[model samples]
Target: MQLIKLCDFRQPFSLNDVGCGYGALLAFLAKRHRGAKVDYLGTDLSQAMIDQAKPSPRPSMRSQFVVTGDIPRVADYSVASGIFNVKLNQPTVRWTLFIQQTLAGMHAASRLGFAVNFLAPPGPDMQAIPELYRVSPDVWASHCERQFGAKVELIEGYGMREFTLLVRR
Candidate 1:
């Protein structure tokens, strides 16, 4: 939804879907941007996801699905949706490292920018949970700005329990 608006779509460009699952985002983009030219690549770590997304790829755009540890090619823009939500018992330090590495990769692989969403930290009245990672938007946005020298924006107040970080290079 909001992730699609992270970059300008009036011109031809490439997009890398980091951690894409089943190509649903690709399909939605293709449908939403019918007249705009786009090159879409969806990368996932799971072979099953790639397999499921390979068939009947979106016809509105040049599309490919790859099972890879990282995006294999540079694109005009990139997005990671719901990738940082699941912590799965991983220590916060280790997961933060993974986020740093992944965001670094995203910055290096995109010519324009990248967008990612993180589950918002629970309120003081609510107890923190272990299975899900609830992070402060400022924490990661500041990290992107400092580490990548990118103009970072935090999009919130959408009535959702999450926020998006739009990093422009």
Candidate 2:
């Protein structure tokens, strides 16, 4: 939720949650921004995740979940959390391309802007994990600015060894 603070909740808005797992963000919004009207769409690559996200009795008119790698519709804002962290055994070049492509899709799907979080480089005391994709915020901030002409803000120091990029168009 902190990562998506760039979006204005004062007014009703639409949100696309990329790589959404079990619709956690939707649940968070229900608790934290209950008064704010939101049209939420949660998309994940895993069908199992989407199945779990569907409401038990009946689906809400305001929220929907789909299994897909791409956003199905444009929204006021798009957010991706923890999507860039686990690269597993994928090569750096392939993983970088994947990140770039995902960012591009998010930018295209968003009307106002988008937000995403990335794992920052491991500190001196923290051992770097080979399976995790970590880098300075500038790598993506620069990419968004150069590729999409976005006003990028790097948000850090939130008590986690990670950073969020608020990309506003």
Candidate 3:
């Protein structure tokens, strides 16, 4: 819900959910924003995920699901939820580069803005894990501002283990 709040839903808009799995977010968005018209396009690398994503029958909304390696079209806003949390044994530097590239792509694919969440680095009482990519908000906020010249908003303190970066073009 916090990630969706980053978008302006006062009017009709299109959304591209990168790495969207099973289209749960699309359903949630449609159900939550009853008055807002939304055209949702969800993309995933796994065909199984795409197959499992049932299209919404809401007359106010239209949806498409695809199994693609990248975003297929531009949208008014894009939100990638829980996409960067898993590193899958990749080196930290390598995963960081992947994140940078993905953010660049998301920025290019969105007309209004984009939001993404990252797992925050564990506190002193928590032990660090190698398979997950826990990133500091400052790192990607600075990157978005520098690379895309975007007005970046760091959304934290939501009682979640992660923080969101809202980059407005």
Each prediction's TM-score versus the true structure: 0.94, 0.95, 0.97
Decoy 3 TM-score against native = 0.97
By summed lDDT, the worst window of 10 consecutive residues in model 3 runs over 1-10
Q: Candidate 3 — which pairs collide?
A: none
Residue 87, candidate 2: Cα error in Å is 0.3
lDDT of 2 by residue, 64-130 (tens): 8999988999999999999999999999999999999999999999999999999999999999899
Model 2 regions more than 4 Å off: 54-61
Candidate 1 lDDT over 1-169, as tens digits, reads: 8787776877888999999989988778767777767788899999998888853334547888899988899999999999999989999899999999999999999999999999999987889788999988989999999999999988987998899999998
lDDT of 1: 0.89
- List candidate 3 segments past 4 Å from native: none
- Give candidate 1 misplaced runs (Cα > 4 Å): 54-60, 124-127
lDDT of each: 0.89, 0.89, 0.89
Order the candidates by TM-score, highest first. Answer: 3, 2, 1
Q: Scored by Cα lDDT, where does model 3 land?
A: 0.89
> Tell me, what's the RMSD of every candidate?
1.6, 2.0, 0.9
lDDT (C-alpha) at residue 147 in model 2: 100
